[model samples]
Target: MTEPADIPSPERVLDAGALRALAHPLRVRMYDILSQFGPQTASSLAQLTGESSGATSYHLRALAKHDLIREVAGRGSARERWWERPRGSVSFTNPAVMKTPSGRAATQVIMSEFLNRRHQQLMRYVGDSIKTPEDLYDAAAVISSTTIRVTEEQARELAEQLTKVLSDASDRFRDQEGEGVVPFSLRVDLFPLPPESN
Candidate 1:
């Protein structure tokens, strides 16, 4: 699936200011919505979020202050500005930021919101799988889980390998555009299970 730009390059880590700016629940949701759905006016986002346009507009300005989102060039008027997430990956792991109490709380909010959004999407897809077209279903749709034992170093290697594969594929197909083109979410989770309780 084509991201809005050339390649899914190195992730940009959020500084304390940006982290605090996005710590709000609504802001986090707005950020995710923009990443998934592309550009939108505050009015449009308000409708999708069930929030007042005034509120959405205010929060949008806050997000923009940290460069989390930017106004679409030459699009929309002063009364109706369009905004979109810049094309790139962003990492929430900031060691310096995490040392502060506020930063830790902000990270918790951000991660929780993101995970909830992803889970909602997955559930929706699973619920609608039966109604999905056979061709689309068979082509590139799957839900799978496998557990295996691995050393900590091995787990790190596996994560890197899988990331490289996905990034390569994303870079290769990022410029493809046509009638049938659409966005797709590619997810990969590689983590060790917790120890059994005594």
Candidate 2:
């Protein structure tokens, strides 16, 4: 199990090569699935994602090269090799280390693929459960905008507070052992006005 309070920000932007390794849609799908389901064999993932064993194995290797996934211990013959995500969550700097045009393209492809997979998952959950009451589904949404007059220092402090709150919440659920049917996401984003507007 992971500790929410221990979640760490990315210390360095991913290099072009690492980003390229992760630039595939299938790879992103594999990462997301493994992150949520724990360690799984290539055959099992292929079955779940409707991809061939060879393809899944190839992508899993690529993800491993990027330190995004790794093989877990198991037996031989009937023994299946398993894989898992390196972390519960990942965050990175805006300008990744892309030394060339191809590198930039690869980064774009990977990010787009990851985002699309997330969107699909969200849509599926919403479609299946939107009609259910909040108590039944454990779902809630709040939209609020604030007009604040604050300096850059204040904004940074606010961001830190928000991150701490989220980390605390994630920690609270880290050890949940099949006690409930609730699935939830705690997403938070903060952005400042563009230079011209500012």
Candidate 3:
């Protein structure tokens, strides 16, 4: 569980070609899997994702082409190369990227694929969980929240705070190898908009 590095300034926009390269469902899935699991070989990823080895290998190459992921050196294994995510996370100005037809399509495809995967995971969790009051309460205890109205500077501060909290928790468990703790995901989202929009 390596800590994420310093949060950088938000890009006002992202390139159309790069986003287009990321638009495929398989590519986005590969990115998310690699980001969560760290470096892995294509064969390992294929088994984890339940996709054909050749298809996984192909999408891995495509993702590499767009600089979203990169091959990392492995220990003297010529048959098995490892890959990793380029960044901790990705962001872009939605409106700025949507001006061009291809850009808009690419944006829609990437977002839809990401959100659909999230929704499916949430649904699976809900479906498999016990419906009792005590069970729900236990689940609720794991969640936290805060609200604030802020300038851009404050928003950046909030982002840093959230990232630190998650990173610290990750550090705590990282050393306990083979403890068999269920891996949980941390999701952080920030939106600043006029009250009327809500």
Model 1 Cα lDDT, one tens digit per residue, 110-135: 99988888899888877677677674
Each candidate: RMSD: 3.0, 4.4, 5.1
lDDT of each: 0.85, 0.69, 0.70
lDDT (Cα, tens digit) per residue for candidate 2, span 19-120: 777777788788878866667888999999999998898888888887877776453234567787754445422364555678768877877887777778
Q: How far out, in Å, is residue 40 in model 3?
A: 2.3
lDDT of 3 by residue, 74-145 (tens): 432767778887543466336767888888889888888887887677666666565565666567334444
> TM-score of each candidate?
0.88, 0.71, 0.68
Choose the strongest candidate by TM-score.
1
**Segments in model 1 whose C-alpha atoms lie over 4 Å from true places:** 1-8, 131-139, 170-176
TM-score-based ranking: 1, 2, 3
Residue 57 in candidate 1, Cα distance off native in Å: 0.6
Instruction: Give Cα distance to truth, residue 166, candidate 2, Å.
Output: 3.3
> How large an RMSD does model 2 have?
4.4
Tell me the lDDT of model 3 at 179.
Answer: 60
What is the Cα-based lDDT of residue 197 in candidate 3? Answer: 60
The superposed Cα distance between candidate 3 and the true structure at residue 185, in angstroms, equals 1.7
Q: Looking at model 2, which ten-residue stretch has the lowest summed lDDT?
A: 1-10
Candidate 2: C-alpha lDDT: 0.69
